[model samples]
Target: MTPTETTTDHPPRAGAKEWIALAVLSLPAMLVMMDLTVLHLAVPHLSAELAPTSSQLLWITDIYGFLIAGFLITMGSLGDRIGRRRLLLAGAAAFGVASVLAAYATSAEMLIAARALMGIAGATLMPSTLSLIRNMFHDDRQRTTAISLWMMSFMVGGSVGPLVGGALLEVFWWGSVFLVGVPVMLLLLVVGPLLLPEYRDPRSGRLDLASALLLLAAVLPVIYGIKKLASDGFGWLLIASVVIGAVFAVLFVRRQRSLDDPLIDMELFRNRAFGATLGIMTAATFAMMGLNLFVMQYLQLVHGLSPFRAGLWVLPMTGAMMVGMVLVPVLVTRIRPGYLIAAGMAVSAAGIAVITQVGGSGGFDLLITGTCIMAVGFTPAAALGTDLVISAAPPERAGAASAVSETSNEFGGALGLAILGSVGTAVYRAAMDTDLPTQLAPEAAGVARDTLAGAVAVAGELPAGAGATLIQLARAAFTDGLQATAAVSAIIALAGAVLAAVLLRRVRAGEDVEPNSDDTAAGQVTPNVVAT
Candidate 1:
């Protein structure tokens, strides 16, 4: 069918029932992000209770993300074959059960196992929610609005996670953090079937086991390596892990091309709108995540603000992001998404440039202003970029397409943390090595060089004047690292802006662009456009 015909015969607009179902769908989406953020706050409490060894503690923290990244593609494809609602409900049930297991776990190993299960279950939720949004909100404008709201929920979840976790830890055990998801999931289980519509591709082929395995092999090692690199710095084992994942990824792609019915539709990437939008989203996420790492640490370690106070200071940025997300649907009606997205990236680059001027002793005003600007600037690409990704795919393959979008985000965040973090760490170490107090013992000096946290701890053990001097030098070195990282991020944001402008210039607002005749000849579904 032609693009015109597709628009002419577009699916009926969603009703109040569909809108209510969106609220129901959003519960799990918020809960999934909450799970990611809340765990970090609980780490100290859980460690005291579980008394886990160093490796076990690492597993407890890292395994959840690792498993989620590994299973996302598989779960997304599974949802396409089974039913999105069905998969969503099943995942909710498993997530709830895992939460319970994690909450009452008797040992470190058990908690790790529970978290791993939660990861796999969590993977099922993200793509299912997005794909369902695609299937439910058939109207272009409605879909964009729904996606914006959906993205907003994630920001809400992430922003409140620390506050909620901190509040719970004050009066309750560490396990209380895990219990937060139980009520949310239980609500999803009860109302989800009654409210949410079921969607699946009737023509989808059976799930390919080998491809699933290959995806796992490809994603797990790379994510693991990235996490290791961020935490432990560069190492031969980590490099090998990344190389192994690359090999498996190549094999996975080749196998997909040969299959009559591949696990994911590779041709979707051939659509320039889809491909370019995905790239922009990933790059934007990379810059945002990398800078966030330094900003948080700077608030606590350099400025010596309490965690709660630091979190309160961050509210403005979150508010700025929420405002931007709310406005994009309205703006997209008047502006070409390509230009709008490019402008957003350009603004983000400008914000990162502001961050580059932040100093060691005091720059609280600049830090908040820059991050809020960055948040506002980045929101357009995140909201509209996601809409384009799903809209550009055939509805039947929306699940797989959503998975690919999310997977790119995971890779982007990990790469940002790893590469930028390594650069910052190297810079800090180099500066600290030359600036350390000569009277300090070698072991103490080495500890101070390792991290800002270490420097703080070691400084406390020194004479009062020396301690103050050491802290001053450490903060200065860390600030240098932050400045360097921000510079790199600014460059990346600008590059993304240029790429979006060049690649997506033809993607006008309020109109759908279909795949060319070549895509039709290749048996690819025509890409849908969001109407004004």
Candidate 2:
């Protein structure tokens, strides 16, 4: 069919019922995002009860994100062949069951197994939610709004995680954090069938078992390697895992090229808009998450706020982001998305510039102001960039397309946390070694060099005079490291903004650009497969 003919056949815009369903579908996405960070607050409690070994302690906290990131593409494609709603409902069921298992686990191994299962189920939720949004909102304008709201849900979940985890811990055991998923997933299970429309690719072939395994092989090892590098500096085994992942990734792509019905829609990337927008989203996330890691610690260790209070301070930044996300869809009706994205990213870079000036206990205003500004600026890039990615793809392949966007996001976040965090840690460790008090023992000095938290812990093991002196020194060194990291993050954001402006210049808002002109637009609208 011609582009005009295809566009004419599209479904009507969604109504109030569809809007309610969108709200309902957002629950799983929120829950999963919250699950990623909530465990940090529960670690002490969980360790005290489960008595996990040092390595097992790391696994208990990290394995969920690792598996979720690895399986996103696989689960997204699985949703396409089997059915989006069906896959979502099944995942909700599994998530609820696993949450209960995790809450009551008797041993470290049991909790790890439960968390691993939760991760697999969590993987199914994100792509299905994004793809469903793709299928639900037919008009470009309405779809942009829906996508922004969906993205905001994730931020809301993240913003609330520590507060909610802290609250639950006061009255309940460590397992209460795990149980938070149960009620949310149970609600999804009950409401999903009635509200969610089913979507699957009729032409999608049998499950590509070998390719799926290869995808897992490609993602899991590399992420594990990165995590190890972040936590333990570097090792030969960790380096080997990254190399293995690179080999498997090449094999996976070659396998996809050979298949009649490949797991991912490789042609989607042929659209310049699709490729560029994904890159922008990835880079934007990397800058934000990388810098925010240090920002979080600065609020706690440098400024001496409690963990829960630190979370409270973060609320303004995320709140500003949610506000900006809601506004971008409306703004894009008049402004070209390319320009909007470029401008927003530049503003975020400006925020990073502000962050670089932060001092040890002297620039709290600058810190909050800069970060909230960054949140406001970066929010538009995230929302509009996602709109462009979904807009660029064929409707039938929404599940796979959404997966690519989501997978890039996860990869960018992981890369940011691993790399930028390591940089800050390295600086802190070196600075602390020089700042150690003369009264400190050799083993105590070594322990204090690892982190600000370790410094505090080791100080508690010392005489009162030495302990106070060590804390003053460690906090100062950590603050210096944070400022340096902020400078690097600012550079990353600025460089990325310049790239976005150049690459996305031809793309415009409101979606009627010529499809054949690759540089001018994302893609032509196709006939809708189902009504919302």
Candidate 3:
């Protein structure tokens, strides 16, 4: 290649500086992901210290995800306009400040507000990281390797959040969980400018404020609705919120279609590879997310494991996922991408079937084993599906494509939590009703029947014999709920595997070109991936 020629056509490989930048990017990816689940393990401790009402407690735990999902698209496009590196650095600064505020929060309200701010900052971080990968790595094969490592970082952070938080909480205050991000962010702020190159779209238009608000209006209400359904079950208010949000979503798309520079070029969805890959990603996430929520509770309440132990137990699954991600990128050079993804999901479906065997009676061995298998099965889809999504997009529109991929996963998580969480809660309530100790007063029985956690708390105040009996039955009831949920997840995963095989059989990696296609039409590339 000529000295003045860029690597858009021919190969221009990443050097040592680019490799160092990937390491730098991993810091924020790991921290953001760790922050997402770290709060879950801190809930009991923080509730005691802050004395938040049930409602306030829910906000503290949930606000970060809600805001991050809501803002991803806007921030993604913003990066293309203003520059990815600039947006990343700005988000890191905001994230560091928010972390400190959250750590020192004196009141529940203060913490909730701080978490919300952090969510906004998190939105800015994700797309910029992925989009920068698209810009930095010009070669197809090298890009895949980069993305796998990046994806692994996020998975590792999520998998170990409890372990890290548990070890921290064992000695430090609950606020210590929030403090983990401070030093990481400070390091990124210092080293990022030195190693990371800036990339921006030369033809990008000024951001449309009205369209941005419309997109937020479209997303936030639906997320609020889903969370409402998860926490309180379906209601008229919840139904209305979802319907209204759908209307706004339609309006947002219509606005995009009219703009000279749309927030997201609608043509991206027309490519079969892009659509199919995103579909697989969404289904896989939807299946796993609900399972994760209930399993965490099961390990803590039923098995009575400390936070660290529970986190350690979850690592086999996460580690398998990490291994699978790296493994598939290498395998893709030999096997067809579609076949690999479809086969992976099929294996996960079988694992989900095995997970249904998890009962109240010493079933943890099966639970851990099945989930590890399931996680390994999921690796191909996570790694290659994202590869297709980014690779299928046109270079200028990579930011929008990255946002869409992340948004699909977020929406999948919300959908899983809302539908399956409600189902599991219903089953637990019904099953526990027959199992609660008869000698308990009506008030105590009511609390006991509400949830396994509530039952455990109530048992603590009972006589020794009654407490032991209540604990035993509550665990059994919760286990029954988990079995039903696992069955449903299995069905979802199987259906995804079949759909993927059909839709993407002809779609191979490193072979897309779109000019009439408005978004980035991917040809081939490498990886940088995350949610947190």
Candidate 1 matches the true fold with a TM-score of 0.95
Highest lDDT model number: 1
Question: Which candidate, 2 or 3, has the higher lDDT?
Answer: 3
Clashes of 1: 1
Q: Candidate 2: which stretches are off by over 4 Å?
A: 1-6, 9-11, 510-518, 527-532
Write down the worst ten-residue block by lDDT for model 3.
523-532
Please give the lDDT score for candidate 3. 0.86
TM-score, cand. 2 vs. native:
0.95
Estimate candidate 1's alpha-carbon lDDT, on a 0 to 1 scale.
Answer: 0.88
State the lDDT of candidate 1 residue by residue for 332-425, as single tens digits.
8988888899999999999999999999868889999999999999998998888888877787788888898889898899999998999889
Q: Quick one: RMSD of model 3?
A: 3.7
lDDT of 2 at 157: 93
Off by over 4 Å in 3: 1-9, 435-439, 513-532
Better of 2 and 3 by TM-score: 2
